[model samples]
Target: MTTYKRMVLASRPKGVVSPQNFRLEEVQAPALKDGEVLIRNHYLSLDPYMRMRMEDVKSYAAPQAIGETMIGGTVGEVVESKNPKYAVGDKVQGMLGWSEMGVSDGVMLRKLDTTHVPLSAYLGSVGMPGMTAWYGLTQIMQPKEGETIVVSAASGAVGSVVGQLAKLRGCRAVGIAGGKEKCDYVVNELGFDACVDYKAGNLVDDLARATPNGIDAVFENVGGTIFDECVARMNPFGRIALCGLIAGYDGEPMALNNVRNILTMRLTMRGFIVSEHMDLWPQGLKELGTLVATGKLKFRESVAQGLESAPEAFIGMLKGKNFGKQLVKLV
Candidate 1:
């Protein structure tokens, strides 16, 4: 094929993201140069972090350039190669953005062993999201056995892994998700000790009843009222790992009314970007991959068929529409 379809940021969102913000275009494929590999992307990862990158505001990483291919993680098979490091038919994962086909110079691509773990899983449980959970829970929270830990957005890709890992570490894992079905999946399927449904309009009361011992550690994903309520129940010397703030992703104000709890309870809170800590990927991915391969770590995916469905799917995810890890199936 001489041309391929790709999506680019057409316009930045003023508040909430809309379909108009993205423009799909067909572009001519360029010839591969030396040390470059060509890949036909099989899956595209739609993550909350991509929303943060859309704004031209100060952040840990530079904003996604307007008119550039939308930023995303992808897993695909190499179809053509000019690089000695990557052979054709080798499966690889890379930051290839939102495109059906991408060319990599072998620098950003990593080969995957899909013998046990599915190819798409490398984008979720055994990939970036998994590493994010591992770093936040193991490195930041550092919960002790018998301690109670609560994770917001508890049914999401990152939060689900956090709660499961906490359970494995002998901590009581309580989840906070949006709906009854999600809450049930968190508790029954993922095996969290309890899951509080935030959409039930009883976040404050429900969270209190779930954590009667008070929370020893918090894996915070949705920051806003959920985070504030969690903070209010934190035990003394609690540790918080701030991963994402999906509640306020659309320029909404995130005001925490329980700031005093952090001081009085002596809570330790740390915000992290998994990409910033490349040194830990080997160790984190190794453990995560093993657990997933052995069925000790379970995960789910909400797949949006075809690339054209990306914009709507992404908007839905921002509004808590996805069940688990949101992904786009591309071929």
Candidate 2:
């Protein structure tokens, strides 16, 4: 039997998660069942949504149970297969968690053609985060030419794509990110019209300057003060797609001071989970894949060394340390 390493949720976190919250263990891989396919994960995706799973709270999805393998998305190659649908040597992506190897019955896995795009791209730009940006911007926001669209966490996996898509549709894209370096990348590389550094201590003023005509739409990822500032500058009939609230993911309570803007500005705000909208995945993924393959869309990633480093990398990502998509190079 082949032995593989995996990380399991040891305990629910209180406030911020630490290394102690996770336990690394080595387990022997079992022989494949009649319909099972075994994969050797090459890369593991680390995303913000994983944080919410760590808490034992009522949510759109169930909390990660203690002693369960830490949930995650992964890209890997099939090493053994008992199913006729999936052949050995096939590359696939699935919710296989934070393990060096995983087994599945081929229900949730999607085969990947790595010739068109890199393997890791399936975890970021042409994958869930990219699809998220598409659903939020094109469906909810519906931004038009000459309109101003603001995106929070602008240099992140979803936010970067949001800004780029807005610009592609002829809207003026403004981004809000953490530091000067990320802000620079958002503006210069991603083609955002302007980027404001939230940590610069001039969030409100900088936002005001960026959206001189007021924001027509917002792709909100970070909540709390940043969200409040965006709401305060929203134009009448503006749309807000509430994708994530990373600011409060560590159990902090986020209070929005601009609640009245929803009524006063006649704004429309919608909170959605990308997974729930399976109907749109085909359309969104096709467009995202084409854009990425054609070089029209761009993205970056911060890769950690191995499975053992996932905890620290995940903790750092929550604290805004990652530049773009954060991934663990399991291979």
Candidate 3:
């Protein structure tokens, strides 16, 4: 019998997740069933969306059940396989629950070609984050060249790509982040036209100065007070692609006092989860690959040491401590 360490959700969180909400447990690995593969996790992505899963509520994905191994997206190497399509030593990304060692029925695991990029990137740039940014910007917002665009949490995994993509398309990108370093990186390194420091306590004023011409498109990531400013600044026929709401992922729903702004600005807002667009992920990955291969796309990750560090990573992400993609290296 093979036993592996697994992190299980201990209880539902109140507002913010603490260490008490998770428990490290030992579980025996089940025998390989038909069309299944055994794998050891290499990297796991810690996303803000996982915060929403901790609570029992209505969401795009079901809430993590009590006592389960939690949930996450991970990259792994196959060690044993009953599936003909996959071989031992193949690296893959699986929408597997949280565990050091796991078995997949081959349903959620996607075989990745490491010859193109690093295997860890499958959980970051070219994977969910990249696809989410691509779909939200190209398909949802549909901004034209020379337009002014703004995205909140612009230094994050999805928002960073969203701003860069807008810049590459000839739009002026204004980013809102937490500090001066991240703001400068977005403007100078990621190529955004300007960046505002939300921690500076001048978001609305800074946004006004940055986008004097008004915002034509917004790729919304954090939704709280920023959502108010976005609605006010959006021009007529402006587009908004709702991504994540890390600001309001707790037990309470987001508090918004300005519903009249939507009608006044004539904003076209659409909310979507990345999982719903898996059909387009192939095309998204191919295009993103070309962009990355040509040095047009850049990625940053705040890597944690091991699987046990996932909880700390998750906590940091929720507190807006991460500047870019946050990942836990399991192996």
Candidate 4:
């Protein structure tokens, strides 16, 4: 029997997540029973939302159980299968957690066509992150052409896509990123109209300069003060797609001082979980896949090698240490 490495949640995080919260163990690969498929994961997605799952608290999804394999999105090749729907050597994507190999009964496993898009891209641009960007922008923050749209965490996986999609729709896309390098990339590389460097200690003035006409729509990822600043500059009847609030993910209090702007500006804010809207996945993924395939969309990745690197990589992602999409190369 072959052995595979897997990371399991060792404990619930009390504050900032530490390396001690995870335990890595080598386990034997199980035999594939009838209607089952065995996968060797190539890439593991480390996202911000995973931090919320590390705590034992009530939320949209259940907290990751201690002593279980850490929950994550994965893209890999099917090496063995008894299921008629899946063939050996098929590229597939699934919520297979942080493991070198996984067994699946095909409940939510999706076959991938990697001829145009790389297999790893399935975990980033054309996968859940891409769907998140699509749903939040098209479904919630429905901005029209010639409008100004601001995206917080603009250099991240979802935010990068949001800005790109906004531009494609003829909207003026402005990005809010942490540092100079990321801000430059958001503007020069991703084609965003302008990028505000929040770490430059002039967030309010910088954002104001970037959006001279005031923000007409917002794709908010970071909450707290960043959100308040955006709210303060929102145009009347502007829409906001409330995604992840990563600023408060470490149990920090998320106090918004601009709550009055929602009423004063008559802004429409909708908090959304992309997974809850499965009916729209086909439409969203189709458009994203086509855009990526034709080179109309662009993305970047920051990959950490090996399964053992998952814990540190995940921690780094939460701190905004990694650029673009953060992934663990399990192969």
Candidate 3 regions exceeding 4 Å error are: none
Model 4 residue 54 distance off true place after TM-score fit, in angstroms: 0.9
lDDT of 4 by residue, 1-331 (tens): 9899999999888889999999999999987789999999999999999999888888999999999999999999999999999999999999999999999999899999998998988888899999999999999888899999999999999999999999999999999999999999999999999999999999999989999999999999999888999999999999999998999999999987998999999999999999999999999999999999999899999999999899999899998998999999988
Clashing pairs in model 4? Answer: none
Q: By lDDT, highest first, what's the ranking?
A: 2, 1, 4, 3
Per-candidate TM equals 0.99, 0.99, 0.97, 0.99
lDDT of 2 at 250: 85
Q: CA lDDT of each candidate?
A: 0.94, 0.95, 0.87, 0.94
Candidate that would win on lDDT: 2
- Backbone clash total, candidate 2: 0
State residue 282's C-alpha deviation in candidate 3, in Å. Answer: 1.2
Residue pairs with backbone atoms closer than 3 Å in model 3 (clashes): none
Candidate 2 Cα outliers beyond 4 Å, as residue runs: none
For 111-155, candidate 1 gives per-residue lDDT tens digits of: 999999999999999999999999999999999999999998889
> Could you list the CA RMSD of all candidates, in the order they appear?
0.7, 0.7, 1.3, 0.7
Clash count (model 1, backbone only) = 0
